[model samples]
Target: MLGHPWAATELGPLPTWDPAVRAATDLVLASPVPMALTLGDELLLLYNDAYAELIGDKHPAALGRPAAEVFGEVWSMPGVGDVIEHAYRTGEPFLEKEATLPIHRRADVAEQSVFTRGSCAVRDSAGRVVGVLTVAAEITQVTRQLQSLGDFAAALAGTLTLDDVARVALRYALTVFDADRVSFAVDEGGGGWRMVRRVRGELMDEADERLPPLWRRGPADWPAPAVEAARRGGASYVDDGEPLRGIAVDRHDQKVRALAAVPLRAAAVRGGITVGHHDPHSWSAADRALLAASAELIGQAAERARRFETQHGTAQLLQRSMLPEHLPDLPRLRIAARYDPGVDGNAAGGDFYDAFQLPTGELGIVLGDVAGHDVQAAARMGQVRAALRALALNDPRPDQVLAGLDRLVTSLGAEGATHELFVTVVFGVIDADRSQVTLASAGHPAPLVRRCAPDGQARATYVDVPAGAPLGLGSRPVTRTVPFHPGDTLLLFSDGVVERRQQGLDRGLATLAEAVAGAHSGDPRALCAAATAAVPGATEDDVAVLAVEHALRPSRSASMEVPAEPTAPSRVRHWLTGQLTEWQVPETVVGAAVLCTSELTTNALLHAGTAARVEIDLSPERLLVSVADSGTRGTVTRARTDTLSSRGRGLGLIEDLTDAWGTDPTVRGSTVWFEILLPAG
Candidate 1:
């Protein structure tokens, strides 16, 4: 009243002010809540200290100014200026909750504020209203905190892996708590902890998905507070770094003045999360509640992920152990196989495949599937595969092999008394002369053949072998013969490859035929890879594929396993030269073949990271050579000018000296082959 010139002009001298105005001024000054009094026609503003804080920097200067001038920026905001005007004009009191006010706290941006406020008419002793009195309680911070917790719950619900849970929890904690750093740690059960820490500067924009914040790991200097919370199975807090005194901390952690830790509420796992601030902060009840809720959500996600990882690991180990480690290597016949488990990783699949040489020098191929996806089913599949191999070794006939298998399956079913003991299989035998393939099916899907014409065109056809009842049902299998000429590929697969949840088996079979016809028909490895990927989406059942190509064994052919060593390539060169010379091959052809074979061996050892198999077939017209490796380094391609570079010179030599060259990618590794045509006699 003494400092403002407006006080003198608007309400006369301070000592001579109206009794009612004086009483109102005294009331405003005494209240703790935000309050303001607008008196007379101009609605001249008078406010207490609590109300001044709401106006920010406009406090001292707004003593006796008009309401519109004092709050010019936010006076027009809804539920503010309009509500006050209505109370003053109609003499009616107004109360509103969650009223929004766009108050300008910064020069360029307006801060949104939510408040529960009420305004009532201020009347003189004459019983006539002259102004409005407003009282407000800001709930902005509380409302925002609740909204953030909701978002955190929604985000945690979709996380399915341990890494996902850690990443999301750390990011949200750093932002929601306004902390300098956030850490998440899980007890690894052996005195070791896997911890991830994210600092404030690591936060990324919401729209950028390419580069996520850096997640640092390890047990280096674990956060002492978080570990303590996990051990106690409760929350811990300190406002002045009291708990961190005398504890081992890095230079960055030395700046933390406040810390809060919440233990994860998982029943099967032990872990906790911690948040730290650079400046001293008193955690309110709302803050503690939010932290506890967040920790609960994280705990649930982590438990689910832990269970899934355990089951998936067990299933994978069982599936791989039941299958063959390596297929039989033949001189004139090329073989490749593929196996993939179903989407449900918790159960071991019953699909199986095998190939071995018979006592009569013919090759035996078999594929089968049991009826279930469990440990029992996988065990029965192994029994069936082993029995078939033994039966085929005794007699190389396809029908006889299946007949023995049928009896064994029937006996196993009777002994075990389980429907899952029944099985479906296709057994085939390739004659030593490579003239034809004899196959027998026991209630199994028909095998496909990719026949290549002399004109270089190819087509796929399903063999019309008569089907018998599935094994264990006591039906006889009939053997059928198909002409297996050079460049023809035989594809045997389990029904899982052609069974889809959304389509019929016929459509899936047709789709597989089209995919096989379009594949490289001469390369069995490539065909196997293509056939496995023929179905687009997630498969409900496990898939197993086997492809064999007939190369027509020449009068002279040889094969050897090249070791993965520096001297392996040199040995290959020497061995190839000697073999060609012993076969009386032309000198020029021997020189070219040796050079090409050496380059391939060297490339395989360098990139494949495993032992490689090398095979060569020579006839009067051409020499066919291939290098196969079990490592996953697949096909290599180069640009037009890359042939002469040091990194690509191996391919350069092959391209220059060979009549034709290509690469075939298989399930486990790849095959690179080149052909050299000799002069006709």
Candidate 2:
């Protein structure tokens, strides 16, 4: 006896079922709720007499039909059948999902079956999903009500003007609830309904209805200020609005009958709403809920709109302040970068880019975000960005720079600021000679790099440099670096570009990579603009971008011989790997010597450095790994220890990891330095 209007007689004879099926069908028919039976998978509907009452005029013929035949064209749209299938497949009831039911003047369907918040699937006796038990309590009332409220919410979201929400919400209540008219006013200090909207009879203008500073002791009003203040305090009422005391425009006041009022404030200020009707009528619970929900939605939407504006302003200002006026004069390279907030108002929501010259003359570039929207979020972003710039001067290492930025954010505390606030940053320093670019980052978006053939005859090949996370909110983050050849282009960006809601960071990054894969341009700025433009602008978050192309130039570059290390191959390998990665070397070459470096360095340390100091130096031509000890003599002979193992055997392994090995007697100790000309391929 499902709530379906159709009856068994209208459905005609159902197909003959097995004896067990007939008994089960009988039991279902005896139940209190409206019930239905399916002829196989066709979902043949069966309605008991109690179910027939809800349909009023339409029944009998409506029985034994697929839902598609019952609802007609609405079934052709998306999601309806899928929802029903999901319910049947899982044996749970589908409840209160907003769908389009064919019986209404609207498209939204609000099912009222007894599932929790979503669909409750119905199951067979054997625990397999067989059918769906659906009960629609015909909340057309609630549906229309909430729809009007949603409309009001939409209007509020588009506006910054204060009165628009009240006007829209009032109008919604009138139309959705089928009331004659609902009008509202606000009190701008002593002025009543300072901004107003209302519906009236054919000859009357409800918006024009006004009263002076009249005070009445009745249920509806005292004065413009008191009534409006009460309303703004989130107070509301239902009343037979009539003048029982002091008033102006006494005639209309007498004509007005009932009223309802609620607070107009949605985001943190006092606003008021009032609805008027000429006839006395009782409102249903659904109507009242719609009234309240609409007002709330309107208020919240207004706040969201205002916040979007603020963040948008902040994003624009930050971009203007952060991006360089033009690309720097990087030798042999044409560098350009483009940045767009994507959407005008959402620009305030956290992405930023910067390229600036540090006092040391190193080119410092950063791309980052603070991860939220609003004026406060933007302010925090500004603080972190400025702090990052200052901190970069102290260490300038990509990891260290981001660490400092993280510490900066942790130190910022407001009594009510959202926690888990962190920043992600990628920072890089272009070498003075422009031979190589030293890059590092905390958790952040990675930079896109493309190296042009030094011969200038082939197309530029792209390289990827992925750094650690953005600034803030992590105890420890992975450190990363990549070497750059002359004429290499490194394109940096923020998360706003190519990002989608709830899809995570990887998708955006993948899309970005694809955008750059086939480009042939050397102008970083033009390329950047075109690349950024290809990303979807529907993003709610802001985006920041900066691109740098490293080009070689003639410049003096030198590294002093001031280093030491253990001589074991394993130890040497570990130390060299750490130092080289920190200094940003090629990943492939570092891997080749990884094992060899450890064995050679350990051998030198065991037989040297104990009596003096150790020295290790890395240059473009040769990697000099040495160990000096205070001992008067250094030897290349195999050790005579109890066990003649390679631990103290000799410097024989040095010849293995490197091309040659030697020793030197310095002023303080005998120094042994090995040299290996790095291979060229």
The best candidate in terms of lDDT: 1
Q: Model 2, residue 417: what's the lDDT?
A: 65
Q: What TM-score would every model get versus the actual structure? A: 0.64, 0.36
lDDT of 2 by residue, 1-681 (tens): 344433343333334334444555665567665455443465565555545544434466656677666556645655556666667665656555454444422234534322112434444455554445554444455665556666666666665433344445545665665555444443343433333344543222222111111111223444432255445475545555552224323444446566566665554433444555667756556656666676567657546544654555455555445434444554444444444444443344555666666677777777777766655566676777777778777777766776677677666743346576767767787664545666666666667775555564324333344554455465354444466666556787776776777676666666666665544433354346545655654776665567665544422122222224433444455666777677554575466445444543443344333423334444443454555455322223332333333443334444444444444323233445555555543
lDDT of each: 0.78, 0.52
Best by TM-score: 1
Worst lDDT 10-window in candidate 1: 206-215
Clashing pairs in 1: none
RMSD of each: 10.0, 28.2
TM-score of model 2 relative to the true fold? Answer: 0.36
